[model samples]
Structure formats: structure tokens, C-alpha cells
Target: MSFISSPVDWTTWTPVIPATLMFIVKDGRILLIEKKRGLGAGKINGPGGKIDAGETPLESVMRETQEELCVLPINPRKLGELWFSMGDIPDILCHVYRADDFTGTPTETEEAVPLWYSLQSIPYQRMWEDDIHWLPLLLEDKTFLGKFVFEGDSMQWSHVETGVAW
Candidate 1:
């Protein structure tokens, strides 16, 4: 595959948008969502959204989880970070978290439909291409940082480092 290089230098990159993603893993199953609107719509991913002004990443993750899945993640732990450069679009920095427990039921909303998949059967083909590269580190409870450049939905270039301190 031919890879496109990022125009912006990653070492000095700053994201125009900051977001969060939370996965609730329990009993060998992980909770994900079929996003119905906004970026990554029609794809399966964790329930999360952009962080609001004055909201910490943790606060944003909890709020987003509740808004998208109607569940309050309990004792959520930060797992990693993902940075994306999608062509001319501004860069995005997403903080990822994992919650082994939560309150309430995973329900369908106008924004998303929650689904549980076994850890061994995560649907990578239905998610962003970069997910297949870093999600395994998340499932293994490893800390990581992933950077990627994309053209539309296709990943052009990528880098991932595990055991990274966030």
C-alpha cells in the first residue's frame, strides 16, 4: 500500500479538536456503539464525543458515555491516546479509556446503538482502519500512543508505541 506523509510535523502537532472514547469491558465482552451521526457515523466504536469547555477528559468520557449509551461508566481508567490527521481537516486528539463496570443499561439512542462484542471478535473491519493497530493494546491494558494520517477513511501512515506514559 502506498502511504501518504503528514504535512504537519507530528513532533510539534497540536490538535484542533480534543475528544474522548470509552469502552466498557466486562465478562470478556466489550461495549461498543454503532454511531448514527457526526464523524465516524455508521461505524462501530466506543461511545464518546468532543470534550466541552472546562470539562476534563475524564468528565467528558463519562458524560459522553451517558449521552450515547445511557450508562455511567464506573471507575474508568485512561488507556491511551490517539492522534489523527485527516487530509486538510484539522487534527484530532482523542483520549481513550476503559471501564470494566458501569451503571444502567446499554440502550439505543438517536446518536448510537450500543452492542457488546466478545474480546476475541471485535469488528475491526467495521471500525476505523487505525483501530486495528492500537485496540489490541487497549484490550491488554497496555498504555500506548497512536498517530495516524488518513485520506478519507483510509489510513495513509501510522505509528504506535506501547508502554508509553501519558
Candidate 2:
């Protein structure tokens, strides 16, 4: 199930795990997190986690955001989907979302530390390599689909397409 090459057959690819990520963007800043555990620990990213049994991606995103950041995102909208193949780990499919509003304060938890960065100041170097390819599209309110292959913390290959519908 390796996808460490270009022109991956995405139509036939299936993920072993389904996850979600949510970003709260407002006032020229986006809410990100310094992950404290699990995959991508110590990296900056949005609040999200694996989808629980019987839970929709949207439900998982909202639940994860509250558990990690103590905030409930308002009017979150689906923006894109990402598929990842990391060597030695099961394939993952992540649903990404964005919300312009939220209730409650962004607080740190055992899972993550809340952080806000201006649109022009995203610290890409400290985030996942694939983020640099598709995050811009999310900020511009464009839909996207991305696939990536990684070995450890280094990305081996990637494909990204914008203006996708669902």
C-alpha cells in the first residue's frame, strides 16, 4: 500500500484511518495548535483527531477542537480533504475545515497549545511539509484535494489540486 511515487492511483486508494482538522480563522489570524501528542506531536497544526465510530467527520472535527482547544467553532465549513501514506503506518484520510467564529477561549490542554498566527506569518517550516502546498488554497476559500507520501518527518512525494468539489 505504498504511494511513494508520482501519479498515485487515488481512485483506488483507501485509508485505514479517517481523521479531521479544524481551523478557526478570523481577524486576519488563524488558530493553530502546537500538538502535544500522537502523530505530528510538537508540530503546529489545527485542532482535530480520529473520527470515532458512528461519528461524522464534522462531528469529529468539532469534538476534537473542543477537547484540544476548549473552543467550539461556529459555522465550520468543509474546505478540503487530504490523504497521507506514511511508511510503516496505516494510510490516513483527513477532512479539513475552517470556521470564522467560535465560542469560549482558546486554552491549552494535554493534547495541544493554542496559538494564533496572522495570514502572512504562518510558520510553515515548523509544520508538515504538505501544508505549504494546500494551506494557501484553504485561506483563499478554495476547495482542494491533496495526497502525500512521507517517510518519518520528511515528505517523499505529493499531489495537490485546487478548486475541487468535495
Candidate 3:
């Protein structure tokens, strides 16, 4: 079967979950986590989680960062949004952010093992496949909108629109 099947018909589907992710960078390094529990466990990703009822995406990202890493993100900028769909799972809408300022040192919590990596040496093989496409744009301080279809944990197809951050 072709991985690139047909694009999802958003008009007929609804994304039930709203999530957030933040990348904290400084001096050419970025903070990532090895999730110890919940969705995407064991994968390397930025700190973030589901947006709670009555909370904005930015608020959720900051709260998640503090809960997962024991640090509060400061001045986080909205980098993009990603919509994901899998064969039989409910769709997900994820808001992505980049935070260059934060208070306190990041410490590993029960939810994640926090680690820092040089931008050029990011462990993409250990992250979600869709990250490979949009992360570079983030590194360049560009904004993007992305969509992806996944089969299980593997990305079946993806599309990204760049240059809309400003």
C-alpha cells in the first residue's frame, strides 16, 4: 500500500485532543526529554502535554514544561501548529513553541528525563519522524504549519507550509 494515501478530510473529522510542545534552546543547545510515561513514552521530544480545560495552548506548554522538567519557560514564542492523524485514532492538534528564556535549571522528573543536545547533533532517530521535517525550520527561527498521517508510530506522510511565523 502506498504510504501517501489521500489527505484526511478535516471537514468530516474532528481533532479531540489539543496538545503543546516547547523547545528550549540556548547557546546552540536544545532541551529534550525521554518520556518515561504516557503517550510517546521512550521517545525523545520537547517538554509538553495535553491542554487542560480552560487553559490556553501557551499556558499548557508552560505548565507542562514545569511539570515535566521542573522549570518554567519564559517568553515562549509560537512556532507552529501540527495536525496529526492515524488510521484508527482520533486526530490531534499540537501547538509548537520555542522558548529561549526560562527560570531555574531543568531537572528530570517522574515524567521525563531531561537532557540537552547541541542543535547540530539532535538525536532525530530517537524522535518522532515528523520532527525531521519541521525542526530545521524551527532552528532557523521560521514558522510553519504541518500536517501528517501516521500508521502506528511511523509517519506515513507529511506536508509542511513554511514562512508564516511572523
lDDT of each: 0.92, 0.93, 0.89
Where is the poorest 10-residue window by lDDT in model 1? 1-10
**How well does candidate 1 match the true structure in TM-score terms?**
0.95
Clash list (residue pairs), candidate 3: none
How much lDDT does candidate 2 score? Answer: 0.93
Work out the TM-score per prediction: 0.95, 0.95, 0.93
Count of clashes, each model: 0, 0, 0
Query: What is residue 94's positional error in candidate 3, in angstroms?
Result: 0.3
Model 2 compared with the native: what TM-score? 0.95
* Cα lDDT tens digits for candidate 1, 83-115: 998886778999999989999998999999999
Indicate the residue-level lDDT of 41 in model 2: 97
Runs in model 2 lying further than 4 Å from the true structure: 1-8
lDDT by residue (1-166, candidate 2, tens digit) is 2244564577898899999999899999999999999999999999999999999999999999999999999999999999998877889999999999999999999999999999999999989999999999899999999889888888888988888887
- lDDT winner between 1 and 2, please give it: 2
